[model samples]
Target chain A: MTRVASMALATAGALLLQGCAGWQSALDPKGPAASELAWLIWFFTGLSALVWVLVMIALVVPLMMRSRAQAEPLAIDAGADGRKLRVVMTAVGLTALILVGLTLLSFFANRTLAAIGSDASLTIRVTGHQWWWEVRYEDATPSRILTTANEIHIPAGEPVRLLLTSTDVIHSFWIPSLSGKLDLIPGHMNVLDLKADKPGVYRGQCAEFCGAQHANMGTFIIAEPRAKFDAWWNDQLQPAAAPTADEAKAGEELFLKRPCVMCHRIGGTPAGGTVAPDLTHLASRQTLAAGTLTMSRGNLAAWIADPQGIKPGSHMPVVELSGDELNAVVAYLEGLK
Target chain B: MRAAVAMLLFPILVLAACQREERDTRPQSALGSGEQPTPVTTLEPGGQRASASDNKAASFEANAFHMSEGKRLFGWFNCSGCHANGGGGMGPALMDEKWIYGSSMESIHATIRDGRPNGMPRFGDKIPDDQIWELAAFVRSLGGNAPSSAAPQRNDDMMVHPSENRLPDAATLGKSP
Candidate 1:
C-alpha cells in the first residue's frame, strides 16, 4: 500500500510540475514589450478585484444596517430618501471614475507598446503558413536577406521589427515571453516589435485556430549576444556543409534522388524544393518538425520513416526506406550543421 | 426599425456562413461532371494550353470564360508573389520565349506537380490538381498567345501596384464605418 501510494504521489507531482513548463509563460517576461504587458495585466486585475470587493461590501451593507435604519424608508422621511439618493449617485460616480482611469491606463499602455517599435534596427518578415512560420531576415541589399523557417534568432537587448502576414487562413503570432499576440491577416500586414533582455531560447505557438495542425505549429526565438548573433547570421548565409563521411555522402545522394527532393531544399545540393523548410542548417536547430521532436539521429530517422505517426496531419510525408537508407539520410541531415 | 433591419440581416449572415468552400463561381450549366483532365495530367494538352503549346503538345480547344477562371486562380494562389503575373521573380519568366523545361502541356503539368530543383515549390500537396491545370493554362498564355478575350483581368491586389492597377488609397484601406 505504501509503494502504491508513493507511485500515485509521484504521478501527481509530475502532473503539477508540468503546469510550470515555460514554453510561453506570460508571467515570465523576458523583454520590454512583455514586461509592459505584464504590468498592464496585473494593474487591471488588481483594480478589477478592488472594484468587485467594494461592490460586495455595498451589497452587504444594506443587509447589515440596523433594523430601524431600514424602517426609515418605510416611514417615508424626506432626509432618508435624499441620503439614499446620495449613496446611489456616489456608487455611480465611483464606477465611472474607475472606468475612465482604466481607459486612460490602456491608452498609455498602447503608447508604450508603440514606442518600443520606433527604433528597431533589424526587420524580420514573418509569413504565417497553415502550420509553420516562414521567417525572413531583411538586409538593405535584397540579395543579402536571409530566409529560414520555424526558428528565429536575434541579437539580445536590441529592438527588432516583425512584419507579420498570412497567405492562408488567419493565424496569431505570439511569443509570450517576448511580446503579445498579433494576428496575421491574409493580404494585410501587422507589425509587432520586441526585444529580449537576456540571451535565452523562448518558445512560441500559433495562438489562433488556423487548421487541423494548428496545435503542432511551434516556433522559437533564440536571443544571443551581438557577436554570437552575427556568427550565427554568417553561418546561415553560407551554403549547407559538405558531407565528410561516405555514408553521409550516400545519404545526401539518396535524399536528392528520392521524393524528398520534390518538397525540401538542402543548399549546395541539386535537391531544391521550397515547399518545405530549408535544410541548409537543419542540424543547428534544436527540434525537428517544428518542435515535434528533439534534434537527434534517432528522431530524424523516426521522422523520415513515419512523420505521420508523430505529427498527424503534418505536411511531412512518411518516406519509406530500408533501415540502412534511413540511417544514411539521418546522418546526412545530422551533418547539415 | 433597428430590430426589423437586424431580423432581415440575420438570415443573410447565416447564409453567408453557409457559403460553399468549393468554387461555384462558374455558371450553373457549366457545373457538370465533364471529363476534367486527370488533376495530375501529363497528357498532351487539349484547350488553351495546347493552343499556346505551338507544336509541342496535343491540342484541345478551350473557352474564354475557362481561361479567365484560370487567370483568377493565378492571383488567388499567390502566383503573382513569385512569378509576378508570369513575368517571374524567383521562378523563371514564363513570358519568355526560351523554355528551360519543355513548353508542352504534359511537361508544364509535370513541373507543377513534381516540382523542379532550385526553388520551384511542389504545389502538388497544397493545390488541387484541377487548379494546377488552370494555373498551367493561365501560365502558358503568358507568352503572348492568349486570345485577348481569354486574357486575365488586371486586379489591384499586387503590393507594388502598376499605375493602371493602383486603387484609390481609401479603397485600398477600408471605407470609414
Candidate 2:
C-alpha cells in the first residue's frame, strides 16, 4: 500500500512541475515585466503558505495538550485568561502587519511594471480580430509602415510599445512570458510596453474569449539581435517573389479569378482585398489560421480546401476548386517566402 | 414507458423546428417576370398593388441569413468605399430617408442592375440577380425598412452609427422621400 501511494504521489508531482517551465508559462518569464510579476507571485504564495501553517499549528497545539480537570468545570483561572487575551491580541497585530506588507508589495510591483515601458523606442499597433492578431509596425514614413499577422518580431533587450485595439468585439492581448493581459476594446486604445531579456521565441494567446475560434487564437514574439531584426523588416517590405514554375503561375491565375481575391491581398498583384490578412509573406509565417495549424504545404492545402472544417464559423469561405488547382495554389503560397 | 419516450421526443421535435433552411441562390423565373427594364419610382400608374412575383422577391427581406450575407458582400465588393457603411461618402446616404432612384425593392434592384446616370456603375453585367436582390434587401434594412428581427446587430468595422437592428422602423419616420 505504501509503495502504491508513493508511486502515485511521485507521478502527480512530476506532472505539476512540468507546467513550471515552458515558452508560454508565466512562471518561466523571459522579459523584465514578467520577471517582476513572477517574483511578486512567488513572494505572496510563500507568505500565504507560512501564515496557513502557523494557523494550523495554533489550532492543533491546544487540542493536543491535556488540560488539568478542575473541581468546577465552568470555572476559569483569572491569570490564565489574562495570558490568553495577550496572546490573541498579539496574533491580531501580526495579521494586520502581514496584510499591510502584502498591500505595499503589490503597490510597488505595479509601479515596477509601469516603469518597464517608459523608455520604449519602437511602437507597434496591434489590432485584435475574432481569432487573430493584426500587427502593424508604425513608422513615420507611410510607405515604411509594415503590416503582418500573428507573428511579431522585436529586437532583444529593447522595449517596444504596443498600441492595442479591437476591430470587432472585446479581446485581450496576453503574452504570459513577457507581460500581463491588457484588453483590446473596440474604439478604445490601450498601450503596453515590454522588453525581451534574451533572444528567443515566446508564444502568446488571447486571454479573453472573443468568439467561436477564440481558443485557437495564438501569437508569437520572436526576439532577435538588432541587426537581424532590421534585416527581416527590410525583407518584409519587398513585394512577393513571382512564381517561377508553370504550375505556380497557373495557381496565381486561378487565385486571381476565385473569391480568394475578394478578401486577401498579395502585394504587387491586383488581388488587393483588405478584409483578410495580407498573404504577401504567406510562407514566411510560422503557422496558419492564427496558429490553428503549423506552417506546412499540407496544412495550407487543408486550410484552403476546407476552412470551415478546420476553424468553423471563421470568415474564410470555401472556394470550390479541383485537386490539381489546390496543389497548384499550395505550391504558389509555399514559394511566397 | 410511453410517457418517457414522448418526453424525450418532444425536445428533439422542438430542436428540429429551430433548424434554419439555407436559401437557394439559383436564379428563378418568378423574379425574372417581375423585373422592369426601367426604374419604377411609384406603384403602377393605376395605383395597383405589387405583382405576386414582386412580392416573392421582397419576401427575402425577412431572412436573417440573406441580410447578413448582403452585409458581408457590401464590404467585399468595396460598396463601402463609396457608400461609407450606408452613411454615404461620394454616393448618396442609404440610411437617410432620401433615396434618389426609389425606395421600393424592384426600383432598387433596377438601379443596381442598370446604373443611374453620373455615379452608380452598372453591376448588372458583373453581379448575378440573386445577389442584387440580397444587396437591395440590405440597403432597405440600412434605411430601417427591414424587420428588426432579421436585421444585423452590429458590424466588425469602426463604430459609425447605431446598427441596423437598433434603428427605428422607417414607417415611424412619417414621410417618404
Candidate 3:
C-alpha cells in the first residue's frame, strides 16, 4: 500500500511538470518574456516536486518501518526514539521556511518588474467596448490617431505604454506572451507598460468576460522592426485616397443614391459618415470589420449584405441593393487604396 | 421531522419533473408544428441564425463561406465595435430588418467596401474584393431590420453621399488615381 501510494505521488508530480501541449501554453516560445516565464515555472515546479518527495518520505517511511515492526517487534522502539521525531519535525519545518522564502522572492521579482517598466516612450490609448478593442496611436501628425481594431503593431525592443479604458462596460486587455493583463474600467484609465525584446506576432485575448461575444474578442500584436514600423506609420498618416474619375463617379452615384453614406465615412468624400470604422486607409488594411473577416470582395459582399449572420450583434445596418450596385460599390471600395 | 423532510423532497421532485416535461414539449412544437421560430435576437453574435442576406433572393450557394471568411476578418482586424457583436450599438444593428441604408446585395457590398456616412468608414481599397464580399454577406445574413418577403429593390434616388475626412491626400493617391 505504501509503495502504491509513493508511485501515485511520483506519477502525479511528473504529470504536473509536463503541461498540455499546444500554442495555448504560456511557456511556448515567442518572446523573451514568455521564455523567462517558462524558466520560472520550471524552477518552481521542480521545487514543488522536491517538496512532494520529502512529504512522501515522511509518510511512506514511517509506514514502511511500521510494516517491518510487525515482523520484529523488538526493533519497534529501537530507532523510534525521540531523536527520529525531532529530525522529521526539523526537516518539515525547514522545508516550510524555504517554501515561504521562495514565494516571497518571486513576489518581489514580479513587483520589481512592474515598478521598473511602468514608464514608456509611446502611449497607445486602448478603449474596449463590448467585443472589440479600439487602438489609437496618439503621436501621429495632424492630431489624427490611426484607428485599428483588435490587432496592434509596435516596434520591437521599445517600451510601449497602453492607457486602457472602456467605452461602456468593463473589459480587460491581456497579451500573455508580452505582459500581464490590465483591466479597462469605465471612467478610469489603467496604464500598462509592456515591451517585446523580439519581433513576432503574439496572441492576446480579453481576460474578462464582458458580454456574449466576449470569447470572440481576441486580437494579436505584431512586433515589427523599427524600419518596418516607421513605414507602416507613414502609410497610416496618408489621407483616404480619391477614386478614379470613372470609379468616383460610380461611387458617388452609388454613395448618394444607394443609402451608402448614411452610416459610413470616406475621409474627404461626401460618404464621410462616422457611424462605423474610419475608412481613410480602409483599402490598406489586410482585414476588415474589426478583424472579423479578410479583405476580399466576396466576403465584403456577404458582410455588407448580412453582417449579423457572420458576427452577431454587429452595428452596421444590413443595406439591401442589387447585384450590379453591390459590384459598383465593391469596385469603388477596391479603388480606395 | 421525517414527515417534514418528505414534504420538501416531494415538491422538489415534482418541480424537476415539470421542467423535464417542458423540455420534452419544446422539440415537438419546433419540429412538426411548422411554427416560425420567432428568433429572439440579441446584441451578441452567438445567438440565433442572424444571417440577413440568407432570406434574400439570388441565393449564393456558398453561404457559409462568406460568413466564415467574415468571422476570420472580424477577429483579425477587430470590427466588433459600433456594430457591437454584429448586431449594432451606437451604430445601427446589422441583424435586424431596419437598415438605414438600402438592403440589396450591391448596396450592402458598397457600404462595406466604401463605408457609410454618419461615421461608417470605407474599406474600398484597404480590403480585397473577395473578403469584402464575404463580410458583406455575413452582415446581410444578420437580417438587419429588413423584411424577408421584400426582394432587394434598387432605388437610385435614395442614394445618400458618404461623409468626408479631414486628412490631406498622400502622394500615393496620384499614383493610384
Candidate 4:
C-alpha cells in the first residue's frame, strides 16, 4: 500500500513539473513581460498557500486540543468571550489587509505591462485569420513592407511592437514565454510589446477559441541577434528565386494555369491573389498550415492533394492534380526559399 | 430488449438524417448543352448575345452554401481588388442600383464571362462556368437581388461595410458615383 501511494504521488509530481518548463510555458519565461507576470503568479500562489496552511493549522489544532470541562453548562465567561471576539476581529483585519495588498500588486503589475511597449523600436502588424497569422513587417517606405505568415522573427534584446487584429472572429495571441495573451478583434487593433533577452525559438498559439482548427493554429517567434534578423528581413524582401530545373519550371506553369493562382501569391510571378497566405517565401517557413505539420516535400504534396483531409475546414481547396503535376508543384514550392 | 434496440437505433437514424453532401464539382447543366454560348458577350462588333438558356441562377442564388462559395471565389479571383467588396474601386459599384451591364442574372453572368468595355477583364477563359454562375449569384446578392436567406452574413476579412446578407435594400442605396 505504501509503495503504491508513493508511486502515485511520484507520478503526480512528475505531471505537475512537466508544465513548469517548455518552449510554450509561462513559468519558463524568456522575456521581461513574461518574467514579471511569472513572478506575480508565483508570489500570489505562494501567499495563498501560506494563508491556507495557517488556516488549516488554526482549525486542526483547536480540534485536536482537549476542551476543558465547564463547571456549569450555562455559565457565561465574559473574559474568555472578550478574548475570542478580539481574535476574530484580528483575523478579519488580516484578511482585509491581504486582499488590499494583492489588489495593489496587480495594479502595479498592469502599469508595468502597459509601459513595456512605450519605447518600441520596431512595429509589426499581425492579422489573425481563421487558423493562421498574417505577419507584415511595417516599414516607413511602402516598398519595404514585407508580408509573411505563421512565423515571426525579432531582434534579441529589443522591444518590438505588434499590432494585432483579426480578419474574422476573435483570437488571442499568446507566446507564454514572451508575454501575456492579447485578443485580436475584428476591426479593432490591439498592441503587444515583447523583447526576448537571448536568441531562441518560442512557440505560440491562438489562446482564444476561434473555430474548428483553433487548436492547430500555432506560430513561432524566432529571436536572433540584430545582424541575423536584419539579414533575414532583407532576404525575405526579395522575390522568389526563379526555378531552373525542368520539373520545377513545369510545376510553375501548372500552378499558374491551375486554381492555385486564384488565392496564393508568389512575388515576381503573375500569380497575384491575396485571399490566402503569400507563398513567395513558402520554403523559408518551418511548418505548414500554421504549424499543423512539419515542412517537408511529402507533407506539402499531401496537403496540396487533400487539404480538407488535413485541415477539415480550411479555405484552401484541393485543386485536382495528376501525380506528376503534384510532384512538379511541390518541386517548385520547395525552391521558393 | 426491444426498447433498448430501438433506443440504440434512434441516434443512428438521427445522425444519418444530418448528413449533407456539398457538391464541389461542376454540374452538367452549367455547360448549356451547346445550344447557345454560356452568357459570353463582348463590346466588339458581332459579339455574342446574352442567352436565357443557361439559367441555373435560381438553383445557385437560392442556396446559402453556393452564395458563400461564391463569396470565397470572389476574393480568390481578385474580384475584390477591382470591385472592392462590391462597393467598387476600379470597377463599377455592385451594391448600387445602376448596373452598366443590365442587372438581370444573365446580363451579370455575361459581364463576368466577357470583359466590359472600360476595364473588366474577360474571366470566361480562366473561371469555370459553374464558378462563374456562383460569382454571378454573389454579385446579384450584393445588389440585394438574391433572397435574404441565401446571402452571406459577412466575409472573413475586415468589416469595411455592412455584409451582403445584412445590407439595406438596394432601393435605399444611391446610384454609383
Q: What is the lDDT of residue A119 in candidate 2?
A: 88
Task: Please rank every candidate by DockQ, starting with the best.
Answer: 4, 2, 1, 3
The per-residue C-alpha lDDT of model 1 at residue A85 equals: 99
Segments of candidate 1 deviating more than 4 angstroms: A1-23, A69-75, B1-177
TM-score against native, each model: 0.66, 0.78, 0.57, 0.78
Candidate models: Cα lDDT each? 0.77, 0.84, 0.65, 0.85
Docking class of 4: incorrect
Recovery fraction of native interface contacts for candidate 1: 0.00
What's the alpha carbon RMSD for model 1? 10.3
Worst 10 residues of 4 chain A by lDDT: A312-321
How does model 4 fare in lDDT? 0.85
Task: For each candidate in turn, give its C-alpha RMSD to the true structure in angstroms.
Answer: 10.3, 7.3, 16.7, 6.8
Candidate 2 vs candidate 3: the lDDT winner is 2
Q: Which stretches of candidate 3 lie over 4 Å from their true place?
A: A1-25, A68-88, A115-119, A140-144, A245-249, A252-265, A270-275, B1-177
Better of 1 and 3 by lDDT: 1
A best-first ranking of the candidates according to their lDDT comes to: 4, 2, 1, 3
Q: How many residue pairs collide in each prediction?
A: 2, 0, 148, 0
Judge candidate 2 against the unseen true structure and give its global Cα lDDT, from 0 to 1.
0.84
Top candidate, metric lDDT: 4
Clashing pairs in model 1, backbone N/Cα/C closer than 3 A: B46-B60, B47-B60
DockQ of 3: 0.03
**How do the residues A81-199 of candidate 3 rate in per-residue lDDT, one tens digit apiece?**
88889987898899889889888867865775465355666778888876677778987464556665667889998878888998657999877777767799988999877777888
Give the candidate number with the greatest DockQ: 4
